[model samples]
Target chain A: MEKAIRKFWPIFVLPTLGAFAIGFLWPFVWGVYLSFCRFTTVQNVSFVGLQNYANIWIDNTFTHAFFFTAAFTVVSVALINVFAFALALLLTRKLRGTNLFRTVFFMPNLIGGIVLGYIWKTLLDGVLALLDRPLLALDATAGFWGLIILMCWQQIGYMMVIYIAGLQNVPIDLIEAARVDGATDFQTLVRIKIPMVMSNITICLFLTLTNSFKLFDQNLSLTNGLPGKDSQMLALNIYDTFYARSGPQWKGIGQAKAVIFFIVVAAIALIQLRATRSKEVQQ
Target chain B: MKAKKVVSLLTASVLALSMLAGCSAQPAADSADGAAESAPAAQEESVAQESEVAQEEAPAADGAAGQVYYLNFKPEQDEDWQNVAALYTEQTGVPVTVVTAASGQYETQLMSEMAKSEAPTLFQVNGPVGLANWRDYCYDLSGTELYSHLTNESFCLKDGEEVPAIAYVIETYGIIYNKALLEKAGYTADDITSFDTLKAVADDIQARKDELGVKGAFTSAGMDASSDWRFKTHLANLPIYYEYKEDGIGSTEAIKGTYLDNYKQIYDLYITDSTCDPSELATKTANDATAEFVNGEAVFYQNGTWEYANIEALGDENLGMLPIYIGAEGEENQGLCTGSENYWCVNKNASEEDIQATLDFLTWMITSDEGRAAMSQEMGFVTPFDTFTDEFAASNPLLQDADAYIAAGKTPVDWCFSTMPSENWKNMVGSALTAYAAGTGSWDDVVTAFVDNWATEYQLSAAAAG
Candidate 1:
């Protein structure tokens, strides 16, 4: 049976491999090549070497977007994980209407990012109007905070589900033993449950980190980098460069920015995964 | 066990075959069937139904004449365009497919569609700057019937002897005022000829707003994406136009912004004597401003003739348009901002037959009785085609007001916003203007964005073009 499966493995692997090459690998490689060329479309390209790369910093908005996105990601990741973990812990315990609460909390994740952004914009703007304060588009600080709140609201539920799964997977015997050994709730959570779920922590951290970094639709639909593009993030910045600015060279510069974006995200994700994987317990 | 093995193997093969079929279906449908069949399948249900009608008619006709796929830019007139196309196809037995891009997404849509194998034979360029990006793809219309039917030489976008694009509509924008509301505020259109009078009247109206039973003199100066163009591009055009007139130039690589002070004054008037708080302008949408005007809550709404449909609830006799006064040198003699941004360009990359079909369709749109009616009546367009006689003139009162201005010999302000560099430049200026209006930033920031960003963006585009 093992021999037959091995012989037919090519049939299983080749289909997926072909799809990956066509759908992702081929386009990715072509995109990287196009980053070095000046063109309106992929078919019409003229090589211009490092000119696109050099022009990336000509506008300071790109740099501003990088710092803004980094700050947003840091704040959102920390808040999302912490709140999601707390919710997961609470829901995991024997509580009334636990399933109901879980469903209610997790429902926000089902809404699309654009829809969520626009809905929150309306809601937040109404609240701001009542307070007689500057609206999200007018105030960069408010825009930033609004986005953070929005990201947390949308992401906490998803992360909570993951954390709940991890908490459940923790052997009941281990938790019981910790309690039997005169451990308090906090002590058991700190020493046993947390260490036991390190793998899930790694996954959650990776997911939240990448998601926050790569956010586009929400940023676009919400403030749209208003208040003089003060609240613009990296993905939105790259998109504006590509679509908002017209010229053959702008497309190449946008592509170059995207390549740089890819590298930064890849490096950060790799480092995070490595650091978390090292801390994960054997069992 | 043997039966279970056979079932598992069969399921695996079926899954792989289905995957391959799914992968191969798209390109095959796209290339072989052409856009008439494929575009509808990919589009919404309404478009799909329209194409099904086209497909039904197509089989009975000869295949000598190529099909027309028009990538329409205006979402507001999409239904009208689709109706016109269907009418043309029913008459001529030619398949005409019209796909309208979502508002604010035309450029991106055009870019992607232009790259497709079954690209749009008929497309549009906003103006000179738009023409620059699409110059290579534009088919020359020098000797074509469409070009011959153009009423004015200036209406054609020329590249030497080649007419690359033709302006289909000539639109006018200014301050659209409700006559009754203006009268209630103790003013008339004649009372506000220049910026000074406009300001005085607006201020008095704001003061007497409660007595007059109106919200404010002007609707809220909305700064959202849907509405910001009114100020950033249209209002901004006044400064650029005045500067160009003073410099005696059509276009420039750098703008001096000599009339920015005037621009500031008009903008100040808009925010101060408005329906809502200036700080809240950032979140106000175009729809909000339109509602205020239509509901008789505001006396003045700054928009264009295209907004006729939206503001038609106000009786035609009650509605009037006044030139946007920005205190220019010949301010009293300044007419409404009049020019064309909607220029039709045939895609040069398309087949010769397709190009001819597109040109024929365009000519038919302007010349034929049903076509002229659709353009003027249904679409509310004041077309530049000679075939559209005075009898076929649009009944839109705002357009008649524009004609009145022209008859009075007021020098119409050409659309200089087209030459105001890139959309990014406009965005930066818009953001600055919004920030300034909201009191979060200074007027100096607006100046820097308008003057400095203009030069930089112009240079960037020039560098790329060179």
Candidate 2:
């Protein structure tokens, strides 16, 4: 069977390879090339060396957005992982209505980001209005926390399901052995269960990290970088540069920022994957 | 051996068909170019032969040789534009397509649409600043019949020697006051012409808030995207207008902070005398403000002539526009800020046939009775064309007032706001205004966002353009 499959590998692989080349690889290559050039449309391009990349360094908005995105990613990633793991642990216990709870928890993940942003905006604004606090767009701090809550609500359920799968995969015999050896709940969870679930942790971390980094739709719909663009994230910033700001050169500068954004996200993701995967148990 | 022979024959035929498909696509593109070149010569000849009588006979001469794709900017006029497009296509057998971008997304839509293989033949440039970004793609209309139709030559945007775009409609915006409510509150339109009297009436209305049926003197000055444009662009225009008048300059590379203090005075009044709490403004939308005026809860709404249809539905009789008075001297002579930001520019890069089709459609819309009715009656537009009959002018009350103001020789404040450095600059100012209203930011921040940021964005755009 293996030999037969190998003989027909060209027929099987060619279709997928063709699709990837056309859809992803070609556009990606073209996008990278465009970062170093100036043009409105892709058809008309003139190379200008590193001028675009150099300009990004001086763009105060780009730098501000970078820091904002970085801070948001860190907080969201940490909170999402912690809460998702806890929820997974609680649900995996022999408790009543666990399935129902799981379904309810995962429901927000099904909602589109734009819809979720708008829904939360109304809900949060109503509550904030009662508190007599400045509205989300006027206050940067409130906008930040609003986004963090929204991201957590939307993402934790997804990560929780992954953690639940990992929790279920723990060997019952090993757990029994730990119990027989007089292990406490905390000790067993720390020493055995967590180490065994390292692979799941790696996945949940990667998913949350990348999702937080590339967040655009929710950020756009929620605050739209109001209060003098104080709450704008990196993706929204790049979009603004490309479409919102006028002038022919802004397009090239936007492309440059996008390229740098890609590099930063890729590098950080790879480092995270490597660090987490190394800790995964062989089994 | 027989199966192998059949498979080889199949492969050969498939390869030949694929090559033929590739070869057949080029002529379609080439023919489009040929049509584009021939279109202008034919149009020029017809235009030269007949100037005023071109609308009825022109379509027969052109005979819809090419298609028209109009990337429309106005979302409110989308349905009207589509109806017109459908009507033209039905009458002339020329396929006309109108695609309206969602409000506030027109620039992005135009940018993306202009990059397509079959780009839009007709698009819009708001004014000189918007024209700068799209000048390369704009077809010169210096000798076109459309240029001859304009009542005022100054309404067209000229980039050096080329007439790149023409104002299709002239609009006015100011304090749209509810006359019945104002009379109920014991104030007349004549008495509220200047800032001091306007302030007195507004203060009286606010002081005796419970006695009056209305909520306040004005609606909530919403800080969100929809309402923010009123303050950041229109309200800001007052100070800019006065300053320009003082300096005897039309436009400047960098704006000096001349009348920003007056801008503050009007803005403060708007927030102070509004129905809603000032702190709650950041979350309020333009729709909220509109509802207040439409529901008769607020007497004054800062909007434009385009809003006539929406307000008129509420039985807004005796309602009229007042010049935005910010306590400046000689403001009593100021009419409503009357000018146009909407301009039609033909795409130079489009096929000549497509451009010709677009031009003919515009001319017919401006000239023909059916088209003029649709424009004036349906769209409520005060079109910048001499072909508009007096009947069309009398149809819209807001437009009639605008005409009266013009006739009375009140100096119409030009739409210098259209010359704003960038949309982002306006948004920044908007955000700052929101912050100020919410008491989270100071007036200094608003000034910085306006004056300092204006200079910065101007330099940035100029540098980028250069």
Candidate 3:
């Protein structure tokens, strides 16, 4: 059986493995290489290492976007997970309208990022218009908070759906046992139910963190790194660098920025996973 | 797992096969039947698309398939252009196709379109780098019938031996303000000549914004995504373009931003005293800004002349235009910020019959009275044609301002902002300046960014292009 598995392993894996190499692995390797080269299109490229990397550090907007994206990810992850977990707990009860509430809450995630941005931009601008200015008024503080509000509103529902699934599978026998041991309902939840759903929390945290880091369309359509570059996220920063200049060479710098972005995102994901994994109670 | 993998593999193969088959199986005009039906005709068509000197020397279009295509850059200009196309198609009986690139994605569309064998016969290769990129695709038109009518030879793309494109039309922009709002605030259009006078007027209008039933003299200075170019490119050039006005600045040139501090004076006024708070402007988009301006709630709308159709179509004729004087010393007779963001270029790779059709279409569009009039009405500005007239131009007070600026011996500070690889550079500048607009970054940082980073971007772009 082991011999059969070994022989068929490559047979089973080859297509997907080939696809991965072509679609992701090859491109990822090329991206790292391109970060060192300068060219308009990939067909014609000239190697010029260090310059793209050096320019990225000198770019103040890139620094600001990095910090901004980091802060946004941290705040958004915690809020989304906590709020979603709470919603999941509430909705997974023996109560009426639970399904309706879940469906309604998750609807925002169904809308696309660009659409969400435009809708929120209009809504926020309308609200602020009453205060004598619209959204993006004065500067990007409103834009920053507006984006925060948008991210939360758009994400919470999606996370809640995941959390609800986790809640449903939380081994009801354990909670019952805790209750029989003279534990209060709240105590039972804290000790038993919470520990059982650690995996969900980890998943929710990771998704929110990564999404927050890679945010571009919403950022682009909402603030567009507006009030100049104050609200620019990392993705938009890379996009702006690649297309907004005149000479035929910015692709290298843009590629380098993208590579750095990948590294930062991966590192943050690892750290988040580690942190979340430490708290995970193995079922 | 093995069965599932096999099933997925089958599905993936089917999909890949279908996609490749779809691309390759096109029964296009350049199919195998090409050599059989009309070898002599194909040769004749190629001559029409070649240079006119070559056209003069080549065979006639007796057996040629006369076809034309204009890959239009402006979706807004389609209504007028389509009618013009129909008229020309009727006039010449050559099959003409007019395709409009989806708004803001012209470059992507053009590249893919150019790769096809039956590529656009005529399309807008808009600027210097664009022309440079599309060098092979365009047939040289140094001495075409269309080139003969061009009085302003400056807009032409000149190589050592040839000029690739001749300007089809010209448009101008500065600032579009609410004239009634200004009048109600106790000021007139004539009162806005110099920077001092303009500032005085804006200050007064802003002070009594509520009295004028507006939020402020200028709309929300939204430095946001949907509309960063209004500032990053157009208004940002006020200083640089103003400095370059002493010596005529070309479309492909980037001048050092020497008068940047002077440029900041207007930008400072725009952000500081506006109705919207600075922090909020970062998130704000141009749609919000335009909505306010269109609703007649904002006195000043920062936009180009092309916006007149949208503004007027929305039933807001009260909207007027002004130049970006920005309280500069001795700036009374300043013209409206004027230049072409979209310049039309016909494809050179097309067949001779196609080139002739495009040239015929262009000639008729400019020379024909009805065609020129419709274009003017749609555009709401002066066409480069010396004798063209339209109601939209006559009715629009903004055009009057543009005319005054031009007639006063004041050269229109042609917006040189398109000199950059606009989308990429605009975003960078927009991002860098957002901090300043948000009151977080200092002016020095912004200036340093524009000066030093512009050079870096230039070098980066040069290396990439090379």
Candidate 4:
């Protein structure tokens, strides 16, 4: 078996490796290279080192979108994980209709981003309309909170399912042992239940964090970075920079923005995983 | 594990296909800037003359082999075009393809269609930016028969040896209001001769919004940040165009908007007085704005001739299109914003059969009787062709008022904003302008933000493309 595996391993791996290099590795390298160039199409790209990066720092919209996305991710991750964990804990109990409830909670995650955005926009705008107001109004406070509310509503149900798997995997013996030792339910949860779910917390946090940062379709359809482009998120910002403008030259600069975005998101995700993993008990 | 591997491989292959597909742009759609007024007129005599000339040129009785394809920009304008396309196919036995892109998805749609093996032979090349983008692919028409047919030099963009594009139709826009409403409110179309007079009527309507069964003078108060072109690009043109008209030619071609203060005057008017509150406008959807206008809650609508179909469709004969002449002196004669939204350019890479077929179709659309009539009837717009005289929206009272302005020698503003290709400028300016409109941003901040950001973004666009 070992001899046969060794002979076929490379044969099986070569096509995938080739496909990856062509599909991802090439584009990744090209994206980094193009960030320094000034051209419309890839063929016309001329080397202009560091100029694109310089423009990004000075771009007010970039700064705004960055802050907007960071705040959204931080707020969304905390809320989504907490709410999801709570739901998971409740459903994991010997309760009626738990499977049905789990399925319903997970269903929202299946909907397309654009469709969800439009749905939320219509629902929110309709509610606001009843009060003799419209969406994208002069109320700066309203647009900001409206977006946060939208982010939370769309994400909570998705995070709940990830948390359910983690809760289900928690060893029943650990809880029984705590109960035998005269530990209260709250104490058992803190010492045993919560500690065991650390891995799930890490995953849920990462998904929420990354998803929030990379959100484009929802931001586009829900608000379209509208009212004055004040609500423009990072992904939307990169898109507008590339296509919304007249020339193909910004494509390079937009490419640079994308590379930087990847780095930031990757670093944040790594940091979060490391922080969460450290608390996870091996048992 | 096996399924995981399969799915990953499939995902990788699909991603690769998409990347390659994106690189290969569609052929004629990008190049063919379909003239907003490509429809000529229905003339029996002209058709007979055209057919006689065509018969003399080609005695090939079988029109079966000949085919023409046109990439249309507007889906709404397809109603009349269907009849025209069908007529052309029947008369010439040439198949005509009219693929209309949704309202704003023109560029991407154009490129996608162009990359196809069976690319569109005819498409639009509207502005200088459009010319810059698709100039390489354009079929040169310096010596073509179509070159002799063009009467207006102002419409065509020629690169010494080649004519890349021509603005097929020039349109005009302004304040479209109910003429019947105007008469009912103790005013006449003649009374609204200037900006102040028009505003006075609007303000009066606002004062009696409840009494007159109207909610506001202009629907949602005209501050649609999404459709900022109506203000940022078009209405903002009034001051710039006035300055250009005063000199009878543009000063240096490229301007930093010297009369932004005048722009603010009209802009402030749009916000302070409306159906929706200024603060609520940021979240205000477009449908809500137009709905208010159509419901007779707003006496005025700020749009162009393209909206005539929508207006007529609303079944309200009381709602009419008025003049957009804000406050410029001698602006009474100022017509609606008139120019081509897109221009048709034939693809250089297309086959001889395809190219000839496209040219023949274009000529037929411009000169054929049935083709012309169908176009006007559908677009709710008149074609810019010299021989075309059908009033597409003759029943529209608003067009009636806008035409009077045109008759007074107010040459409509040729689309100067098309040069500024940044939705960045519009959106950024829109954000800053909103604060300005709402008395949030100071004049210094507004101008500084506008010019500084404009220059920086302009530089960024140039650097990225350079």
- Model 4, A1-283: lDDT tens per residue? 9965554454456556766876789978987998998654454467888878887755577888999888877877787778888888898889999999888877877887777777887677677667755454334455566666776767777788777888788898988898999999899889888899888888888888999899887887777776556778899899877767775556667888998999999999999889999998886
RMSD (Cα, Å) for all candidates, in order, is 3.5, 6.8, 8.8, 7.7
For candidate 3, please provide the TM-score of chain A on its own: 0.93
Model 1's alpha-carbon lDDT is 0.88
Model 3: per-residue Cα lDDT over B126-150, one tens digit each: 6676665556556777776666766
lDDT of 4 by residue, B171-191 (tens): 667777766666767787678
> Which one wins by lDDT: 3 or 4?
3
lDDT of 1 by residue, A1-283 (tens): 8977865665677678768887889989999998999887677788998888888887788899999999999999999999999999999999999999999999999998888999999999999889988889888899999999999999999999999999999999998898899999999999999998999999999999999999988999898998778999999999888877777778999999999999999999999999999999988
Computed on C-alpha atoms, the DockQ of candidate 4 is: 0.34
TM-score (second chain) of model 2: 0.87
TM-scores, one per candidate: 0.94, 0.91, 0.73, 0.81
- Which sections of candidate 4 miss by over 4 Å? A1-60, A95-104, A122-144, A226-229, A270-283, B1-69, B79-83, B86-95, B114-119, B158-161, B222-226, B247-258, B313-320, B349-353, B389-401, B436-452
**Candidate achieving the largest lDDT:** 1
TM-score of chain A of 2: 0.98
Candidate 3 local lDDT, A1-283, one digit each (tens): 9976654565556656666766689878977998998654454467886887876754477889988888888888888888888888899888999889999999999988878887887788778767755345335778888888999999999999988888898887887878789999889778878788888888988899899999987997777776556788999989777655544355677788999999889998999899989988877
CAPRI band for model 2: acceptable
Residues B1-466, candidate 1: write the lDDT tens digits.
Answer: 6786676667767777778789766532332222222233245335534654664665444664788988787878888988888888888878888877655666766776787787889999999888878888989899888989888897878889899999999999999999988987778899989999999999999998999888999999999988999999999999999999999998988888899999999999999999998998988899999999999989999999999989989999998999999988888899999999999999999998898889889989988999999999998899888899988999999999999999999989999888878888899899999889988889999999999998999777666444
Tell me the chain A TM-score of model 1.
Answer: 0.98
Which predicted model would earn the best TM-score? 1
